[model samples]
Target: DARVTQTPRHKVTEMGQEVTMRCQPILGHNTVFWYRQTMMQGLELLAYFRNRAPLDDSGMPKDRFSAEMPDATLATLKIQPSEPRDSAVYFCASASTTQGGFSPLHFGNGTRLTVT
Candidate 1:
C-alpha cells in the first residue's frame, strides 16, 4: 500500500516507562519528519531527516526524546523514562523534494501515547 503506517495506535504506559513508536513512510519518499500534538501547543516538530541523514532535531527535547531514520522507509520515535506530561499524538510525515520545490506531506494517523 502507498500509505504512511504507524504501529501501536494507542499506547498506555506507567510513568517512567520507556515507549517506542514506529513509522513506515510511503515508499520512495526521501524526507521524513516526526511531530507531536498537544492541546496547548498544537503541532510541534520533533524530528529531522534529509536523504536518510538527520538534519535538525532542535525542536525536540534532547534529554528524553529521540527520532531516527535507520533507513529510507523506517523512522522511529522513542521516549526513555516517559512522563505524564509527555502524552500526545505523535505523527510521522513524509515528502519528496521537488526540483521546483514544496512537495505535499503525507502523514500517518499517529500513535497516541498516554503515561500515567
Candidate 2:
C-alpha cells in the first residue's frame, strides 16, 4: 500500500521569510499535485504533474511559489518572501495512472503555513 507524508504540519513564520514544504508520495504512483485552500479562495489547484512532467500550473501564484518533483516519492514546494496573504493550508496528493489520468488520489494532511 502507498502512504503519503507531509512535513511540518504547522509552521508560523515571519512575513517575507522563505518557507519550504515537503511531500512524500505513495510508492508506484507517478502523478503528484499541489493544492491550496483559503477562506476566500476555497479549494484551488495550484499545480499538478504526471510522471514528474508538469501537466498544468496555471492556478499557482507564479510570482512567489514553485512546485517540483525531485523523484518518484518526493515532491517539494517553496515560497520565497512569503507574505501574510500566503498563509494557508498546502496539501500534496499522489495518484497512479491506472487508466491514463483516471486514478484516485491520496492526499497528505497538509502543511498549515501561517505568515505572521
Candidate 3:
C-alpha cells in the first residue's frame, strides 16, 4: 500500500510523550491533507499543502504539533508532549489539488492515537 497512512494503525502513548507520524503520497499526487477525527469536532483539517510548496500549518497549535513536507512524496507530523485530549484518529490524504479542488486518490487508514 501507498504511504497514505502510517502503521501501527493504533498507537498508545502516555501524557507528555512525543509522537511522530509520517506519510508519503503516491507518485504525481503533490498535495496532502492532514485531518484529525474527534467525537466532539468530527473531522478537522489540521493542515495541508499550500501553493504547491511546503504546508503552512498556522491553523494548528504550532507548539504542540508541527507538520511539514520535506519532499514531494513525504510528509511528517509531530506532536510534542502530547496530551490525553490529543487522542484521536489522524488521517492523511493525498490529492492533486494543484489542478483543482480536493480529489483524493488515496487516504491513510488513519492512526488511532490514545494518550493516557
- Clash counts per candidate, in order, are 0, 0, 0
Candidate number of the best TM-score: 1
Superior by TM-score: candidate 1 or candidate 2: 1
The C-alpha lDDT values of all candidates are 0.90, 0.90, 0.80
> In model 1, which runs have C-alpha deviations exceeding 4 angstroms?
none
Count clashing pairs, candidate 1.
0
How many angstroms is residue 54 displaced in model 1 relative to the true structure, after the best TM-score fit?
0.8
- Cα shift from native, residue 102, model 2 (Å): 2.3
Candidate 1, residues 2-102, lDDT tens digits: the string is 88999989999999999999999889898898999999999998876878898889998889988888888789999998999999999999999899754
**Can you write out model 3's per-residue Cα lDDT over 1-116, one digit (the tens) per residue?**
54565655888999999998888776778788888999899988888884346565665787899888888777888899899989999988888764556665578888899999
Candidate 1 backbone collisions, by pair: none
Clashing pairs in 3: none
lDDT per residue for candidate 2 within 5-89, as digits (tens), equals 9998999999999999999998888889999988898878999989998999998789998989888778999999899999999
Residue 72 error, candidate 2, Å? 1.2
> Residue 109 in model 3: shift from native, Å?
0.5
Q: What TM-score do all the candidates reach, one by one?
A: 0.95, 0.93, 0.85
Candidate 1 has its poorest 10 consecutive residues by lDDT at: 97-106
Model 3 stretches with alpha carbons more than 4 Å out:
1-3, 50-52, 98-100
